[model samples]
Target: MSEAPFNLVYLGIGTVAWGVAGLKIRAWRRDPSPGLLVVALTIAAPATAFLVAAPVLYRLIDRVAHRGNLATLLVYLGITGFSAAAVVLARMWTPPKERGDAQVWDGATADTWHEVRRRLAVFAVLVPVMTVLFFTGGATAPETPLTFDTTFATVPQIALFLVLYQALFGFALVDISRVCFGHASRLPTGPLRSGIRLIVLGGLIACGYVLCKLIAIGAAFAEVTGTEWLSTALGPGFAALGAVLITAGFAGPAASAWARRRRDYQALRPLWDLVYRADRRLALEAPPSAWTERLAFRDLEWRTARRGLEIRDGQLTLRPWADPEVVTAAALVARRAGLDDEDRAALIVAAALRGAAAALNEGTAPRPREDQVPLPGLDAGPADERAHLVRVARYLYAPLTGEALTAAATTTG
Candidate 1:
């Protein structure tokens, strides 16, 4: 194949890669809501079709230029019109479900729309200006042989599209990375962490490409000739590099998913061991008196809550809420931190004692239910209650258990 055809192939491949990414994203979504699915299909289907047709269009351009430049212009205009319509229609026809039920715009979709709006405004203004310039410049006749000028006219359009495409894809990658990294804290050392790191690196590399492209565009505008070989070379090189980087970006997540499935049985062994050690230490150090304080285990509960655990039916139910293993591991850490056998025994005994005292007090006095207590009297504004709980819990369960327990007992009494 000629260089033209070879370049077309690269373009085709790049387009297909983007299409595949869209489909993959939709497929991988835990819940591919109908609206999102429509959005994905609308974007990806047209993009894929464009790629498949691009080579034929390129060949037609070459042939039609020999016959007449107007034919080439018509073709270009038609493609542009069709592409614009496709984009607008996709946005309009998106299902209500995919349109997002969010009362407030907040996540990845919101960011994508904001970018889309910005890019649309830019194109709306610039395309008209460019069209006028193309007709009036007299610098190059419409009839002038299609050389780099034809390519040049399309440059801004291509650059704009590339910018929007990168922004959307980059945002998706970042969101995914954030999720993966957030899970990393709970996960054992594994491919999940590696995947998140790869995505971060890939995003940085992609950003560099975007920066290079912007610099090239600025150079093109500043140069007297309106085009520089260096600028042109740099722009395409950055775009191609960005394409490769995006492809590499998927590697981490894909690998992580595969690894997690394959090693489910033994993957968390190290994490469990660490938990076990921490639990042992805490159990040995915590004193009986410390366990009497209501806040003694508050920190642990707070941490558990952050990790998606909950107290249900007044039982320490640890399963089906968050990752049970993670909660178990945390419990072990609390035990090893200094909570001792005496502390555990005291917790049981204190619960009974408190219940008895509460019963006797209720018989003697008109005790109000917790809910019946006036909410107006309580400071309900946002505060770091969890932090306070954690501090108290740590003090009650740590090496200073003896002192903490005595203070806690006195305060409670």
Candidate 2:
């Protein structure tokens, strides 16, 4: 295999890891919690590992250190740190059992953290031990960046070092996969569940990398030949692919949430603008401008939520002007057009709101009606309400909606 692909894969994984880590850092700044910081560091650890493992950088690093394989020790340390961080993340992510006993819950949480700390302490001890073994094993002088494991597998010290490192790394991979699978099974289907599944899969593949290296080392110790390919090709390949999957796993849920927020923010614009024109006071914050508001991504969740509330406020304000007959007319038109129940309802609401806004703008005296056009999602939660509003906005300017509003206005006028 060409080193180009390996280098590219490693660099790509590193880039993704840093991106995820940056997001976590941003979140940590908002919440400033320890667990959030740990999550960021957890991702950064493997990111550093892969960057160091890139063939060109690997050789460059070792050469710079004036040690033949110093990059190997650095890479191992990064992986060990990642292993410990993964364990921490797994513990932190698992929800506390729903026991009513507060003390029991506290004790359980404490015990879990204690176990996590104990395991991490063990990894800490192993890091220095592995470094000692690497130097003492006489495996550091040959500059075998890509083939270090297989090349020195026959050396007793090097073999022992490899075994101990792989043991710790493999244990972490298996433990995390098991825990994540259990937690993921209980989660409803969504980006979070999907992300956890990807992590589990990545951990399993990383386990393969550890297993392959250990087997190759064992084969070499037994004076077996022709197994170098396992450590050099298959093992590294598994490690690279696993790293990519794990990075994606961390990024998937975050990216999904960001996309949803952006979509909702953009989708609600037309309805927001219409209501804002009717009553400028509907907007609590003087958004810099319409163009800047569209371009703004900072505090997006807050802005989207504020926009939703403003829309709801506008709907309530304009309800007195709404012609209930518009709702009836639009419903009939939508039914005749064979629109689905959801779209039909949305079109009806859109027509009512549009006519109401027009009435308010036209200086038509607001008259109290016994029956008002009911707004969609009045009793729904914020998310469901926003979703329905987005649908209503989509049909706000539709021909059927316009026709219904015209028919109602003509009759009412």
Candidate 3:
């Protein structure tokens, strides 16, 4: 088959693939926002334009079809202008939101705006240069040009512009992937992330293809002998490679999402396990109450010199004048006829453990350190202080149920 026909076939396949991928991305995200749809359309629009235009443009160049330049330029202007407009509209329609707030739909808007601005800026610079070059009769040349300068001044500039345009478009696609797959909290925690990474990789490969195109253009411009082979071979080869990578990148995430929706958890279990393990590690080691554990009795001493409570032998001590409420609770528990001091101590330990565990589980605030010494009159005696310490310790070690820790006397007794 001729290169034109072959390219046409490739273009058709690419368009179909991109369309399917866009639909899949939409379904996977479960987002029907108009702004998101516009962004998605914008991402695929450049690729679609290039794919459709490639074969026709190649044929026009081969046949020296300068008559088509007007139409071609118009198409380029339309695509580029629409792309810029889509970006601007998407930005205006979607504002940035705080990160990790799942309720926010426009979390990625800022990044999207940055990416769009960059791509528009590139096109803004290149389009005028291209228009000037096209109007100056650069698109038409003999099969073998009379001189290097004639071909060099014309063909390569056009090629360079296409190369830069494709690269900028690819970069924008990568930005879209970053937003949809990277930070999308609604996405299932599995292949979606991997798929986004693959998309980014594919975008990089597309960028590489454009780089190769630039190199080819430079070689053509320099009139390097036999370099035509490089230009011809690299251009189609890189484009094909980029297409394949992008297809895979787009397909992987979509398939993964579908699998998750089908309730095929086992298929995505490994990825979920990794996330679960990471979250578990973060929670266990840094349970917010860890801050309270760091506050020592000495820290309290430094803040206030309440003579009633002191740290001695790693235990909190209370003076004899501590409040009766505190002393009575411990004394009542101590007086239980059937219970020895050891049994009373055991109850205190269980109560403390239960209280701390409950607090941790319930997400309650850590017990305040003795440093915040309740108003002076509220100060309990040594026994009362011991009771209070037990209660506080319980609050810390295990969460206390309100019912279990009713009036300090209940636990002490």
Q: Write down the lDDT of every candidate, Cα atoms only.
A: 0.38, 0.81, 0.45
After superposition, the stretches of candidate 2 with alpha carbons farther than 4 Å from their true spots are: 95-108, 284-299, 328-348, 368-376, 410-413
- Which regions of candidate 1 deviate over 4 angstroms? 1-12, 15-19, 22-30, 34-57, 60-200, 206-227, 258-413
How close is each model in CA RMSD to the real structure? 15.9, 4.1, 18.5
Runs off by more than 4 Å, candidate 3:
21-35, 54-66, 69-105, 108-122, 140-189, 259-413
Which RMSD does model 1 reach against the true structure? 15.9
Candidates 1 and 2 compared by lDDT, better number: 2
In order of appearance, the predictions have TM-scores of 0.35, 0.85, 0.45
Question: Which is the better candidate, 1 or 2, if ranked by TM-score?
Answer: 2
Candidate 1 TM-score versus the reference: 0.35
Clash count, candidate 1: 18
**TM-score for predicted model 3 compared with the true structure:** 0.45
Residue 232 alpha-carbon offset, candidate 1, angstroms: 3.6
Best-to-worst ranking by lDDT: 2, 3, 1
Count of clashes in candidate 3 = 19
Clashes of each: 18, 0, 19
Global lDDT of model 2: 0.81
